[model samples]
Target: MTNLYRSRAMQDAEMSNSSFLPSLPSELLFHILSYLDIPDLLSISRTMHYLRTISLDPLLHTYRLQRASVILSRAIPSRPPLTELMARRVYITRTTLTALNLGRSLTMIRLKRQLERRPTVERLIELGVLPPECYLNQSNGISTTLGLYRRRKVVQKEKVRNFLAEWIGELSKRITRRMIDSSRSTRDASSL
Candidate 1:
């Protein structure tokens, strides 16, 4: 008798906790599901057998694809023409692309040569062109130049530190002033 009573109570609890979506008409549920993306539909399919069947319906996917095609067709006319794109160099023929690539490679080679001939960091430091802070020592006792990125990061950190210090000083002054004013008011009230 106890087992039967417990089973009935569990069934009632489950019935109360069941989702209202399942109780909705199939046509309405499918209409709602049609607005959901593929990922949402897939997630819904994993929740229940009925939803899995509905979400995986080929007709829904075909409809979505057809709608997407229609939207893309409508948007296509708003894009720039091929001639304009070609004139802007956003679109190029294969031969032109090849020529551009060759020019880029030659420029890179020339830049590499110039970089190889550039003065060392130590020489620059000695010449007063670079600051002493640009020198960095590794754990292996080898010294290296601090690249532009590291220098920028160090400068940024200093700026943040200074800003925080100034902000904290102002905040402390404001709090001290508030405390003094409150104390003076309390004293004046007591005197009255």
Candidate 2:
């Protein structure tokens, strides 16, 4: 009795599973499969014998190729040719790559030589190229490029702050003078 019951349950599960894709008409199924790429079609083919036959159909692949060729043919006329694009440096050929490497190497060599000949921070400070605040203190070790940059920034901020403070002081003095003159005028008018 238990064996018969288990067999009936298994049959019901199989029937439900088989009804899913196989229930669709073959033409509709092929239409849906047409949208899937090659890898996906292969995966679906592996899932069942019925799918394997449909997914592996040469007619479907031929149709897909034809569709892709039509798309390419439509697009090709709007774009430049490969040789023109290569000349414009849109595509890097072997010669272009070699020239690029050579240019990079030459730039690096020139930069290294310039760096070797560059003046020290102390010399730059003396020449007024860098601010005096960039000078090394006893507390700090050797001054770095970043340290010099920060010192110059601080000096600039201090100058701006001082200018703003002076402008505000002058503006307040003018406002006070105006208020005093306005009050005196009102008092004189009342006395008259």
Candidate 3:
């Protein structure tokens, strides 16, 4: 009942708590873990001794290492498209990523899961890596093409504002719910 004894008892309780893993085979467990997202897997690994002990499988680890090498090589801007294409996969080159990052409105659309389904012929166009002709309106001749850009400049400004408003408005509800739940949890913990 002394403070030192209570602390020692709590330590022992925590140690014993880690020893009672369910009787799943390690391979099966690893398979299940592989299906989990990084967040969920990391959370489980933190609390479960069995999961923490699981090593990355050799084949999976090697595959990731190889893929990473190609990803890095292809991602280098100086590498030619043909040279990078010869590699396993042509990742978004660092130059393209940098261009996209510099364009805030493009990044916003990308993060909103809208880029993949964009009406543009290619998502790569938004990266600003494409030729100017790709963005040109084919129906319009040269003079009207210049006018098109001016008109689109106005339209894009409005679109960016609307997208920003939509983003903030969507997150506002999620933020309110989280704040309500957070305050409720704090109140319950204090009562305890």
Of 1 and 2, the candidate ahead on TM-score is: 2
**Candidate number of the best TM-score:** 2
- For each candidate in turn, the TM-score is 0.46, 0.47, 0.26
- Give per-residue CA lDDT, model 2, range 164-183, as digits (tens): 99999999999999999999
Model 1 agreement with the true structure over 1-192: per-residue lDDT tens digits? 999999999888877764766888988877888788999998999988889998988888887788889989999999899889999999998989999999999999999999999998779989998777676655557654568747788899999999999999999999999999999999999999
The worst-scoring run of ten residues by lDDT in candidate 2 lies at: 137-146
Tens-digit lDDT track of model 3 for 29-71: 7666555555775687687666766633554345446667887
Candidate 1, 82: how far from true, in Å? 3.0
Candidate 3 TM-score, true structure as reference: 0.26
Q: What is candidate 2's TM-score against the reference?
A: 0.47
Best by lDDT: 2
Error of 3 at 182 (Å): 0.7
In the order shown, what is each candidate's alpha-carbon RMSD? 9.6, 13.2, 23.9
